[model samples]
Target: MADIIIKNVYVLTMDSYELTQGVVVIENGTITEVAESTEQDADQIIDAKGSVVMPGFVNTHTHAAMTLFRGYADDIPLDEWLKNYIWPAEEHLTDEDAYIGTKLACLEMIKSGTTSFADMYIHMNDVAQAVKDSGMRAALSYGLIDLGENRSADVELSKGKQFVLDWKGEAEGRIITMYGPHAPYTCSEGFLSKVKKEANHDRVGIHIHVLETESELNQMKQQYGMCSINLLDRLGFLGPDVLAAHCVWLSDDDIEILRGRGVHVSHNPVSNMKLASGVAPVPRMLDRGVNVSLGTDGCASNNNNLDMFEEMKTAALLHKVESLDPTVLPARQVLEMATTSGARALGIKSGVLREGYNADVIIVDMNKPHLTPVYDIHSHLVYSASGSDVSTTIVDGRILMQDYEVVCMDEQDVLDRARTAASGLVERAKF
Candidate 1:
């Protein structure tokens, strides 16, 4: 008998630029078949009942451990937000706190139909372990911010090597590790070069914040005498494997540099807008052939929910409002950025529905009023459907969320931990 069969679903394969009605067969932790004719039997079957079954979203940028600090310090410039509140609070974050925070992040991700994410955070082993326990797929980065002399870059690099050694391919290959050099302003050239050296050996990708603020842009221009993207390019930062977050305030030459190097950009509109950071030149970047993906950045800035659908809508509309062109970043491209493009950025396999791919899928309740009279599934997904409409989330052929309920973890317990952690973080912040 087949392992799992999903029947009567409107499958938006996200493959070959099309969507259709079909049944999917999953077995051995991989998608075994996709056929319109549900003329088969299985050990288990889900009657999707006309829901939109599509690939699970991939969050290419997130500070998973920072979910503990969500809404603790909002309504500030990006620089001040980091320096005044976030950095100070992060100092007090222990491994237990990271575990607790990341567990909450994973739960939120599951509830919102995100199956995979690229996460940068401290106490990363805790975050990685949380992913392991939750059965969520993630790329865990040990956020290397060595501003203090006592705790140097060497220490962070050593810890990164240890992460690679210990957890690189763990959790049945669900967890991957990356070298995170927080941002250009936070990392010196010498330090980032060392990170590159380590990353080259490991052949893993590097995650960095690029031009999230005008001040950061000015700082890079004055200090390095180069634009942030060009500075990174000079430092050997851009490549096939690099995933740069934010990327606001980019110049034409910067877009050219990214496109030339085939660097992937993680567009986080929610975080950018929340911090009053200006919109990145996404249209220009796309025109220059840059691989752009969508991310929630983190719960602290976006505030508790890593829904790629919302991100997509924000991205599609943000440009129109700024550029005064409604034609920019249409629904089709937005969905691709969230799904297939995001998977490309993180080097994961299953962004589309097909045989032999990892079974990372989500079923959206298309029967809802918001999604009714679906002219185009892509349009409905991007412009209408909310994260709550996601009825099921499956990763590696394992059903994590089913019928609007998370199956693997206690949802209430996860919420309680987050509530406690948030209160504790606030208490400790009163200094």
Candidate 2:
């Protein structure tokens, strides 16, 4: 029997040029059937009320537990923000703090229609537990930074590999583990090469920051005599299984190298702009057939929320203005960056609505004033709609949020705990 039935909705399959009023049947956490009509019986039926049903948003890169640091330090440059504020504050973050903060982030993501995210942060076991308890899908990694210390490097590498072994396919296959070398500047060449070898042996994906700022490029050149992209390529670190975040300072050769290596890029528009980092060459990358996805980064840098709708809008508009071409990144392409491309980057199978796909879906209320007069659904989704319009969010055939109410956890309790935790962290950090 079908576990859940969703009927009376406009289904955006996202696989092809087919948008129609249809029905979707979910059974055992996978889509069993999707058609224009259905007569199946199910445990529960979701009447979508003529709303739009599509795949849930995939956040390619983020620091989920950093929700506690949101709005703590803003209007500062990236270097100062990380060195003077974020790193010191993070030093005081305990495992319990990570749990509480990640719970808050999961609540916000559920309400905003994000089903899956890639997180690199401290206390990853706490983060993984939070994701498991909240019923959200995620790729978790411990941020590995050696700072040129051999002992610290050995400890960090061991922790990363242990995390992969312990949690790679845990939480009923909803959690994926990856190796997170902080960046080219922070991790030595030997450490990076060792990580690559381990990732190859374990067959897990790698998540790392790359070329996010001009200063990083200069440092790489002075230290290693190559750009970040070239350096990674030379170390045999660029591959299809790698998710490189923030390629904002790439040259043409860097673009070509990324395209050639099949490396995925997670463009963080809001964080880049907020930190005064230069814009990424997204249009050129797209033109070269690189798989470019979207991410909101951490809340400390973004300073507000993890809203993929806002990211989509910002991505679409920013590139057009930068390229002096309005037709550069259209609405459909931007939406794909949030959905299918992100799934591809994370190597997940839940970003499209089709038979046998994982039932990770969301319903957006279309009866709003802003969503009225919808000539093009894609355009309205990218240009007009906000995260508040999400009426339902489902992950792996389970409803996490319905009618703007999160079902997996206590909303008020999570918020209250997060508030208390953030205050305590600030006090301890003395910032």
TM per candidate: 0.97, 0.99
Error of 1 at 114 (Å): 0.5
Model 2: colliding residue pairs: none
- For model 1, residues 205-274, the per-residue Cα lDDT tens digits are 8998889999889988999898788888888878987899999989898888899999999999998899
Best by lDDT: 2
Work out how many backbone clashes candidate 2 has: 0
lDDT of 2 by residue, 212-319 (tens): 999999999999899999999999999998999999999888999999999999999999999999899999999999999999999778847899999999999999
* Candidate 2 lDDT: 0.92
TM-score of 2: 0.99
Provide the overall lDDT of each model, using Cα atoms, as 2-decimal numbers: 0.87, 0.92
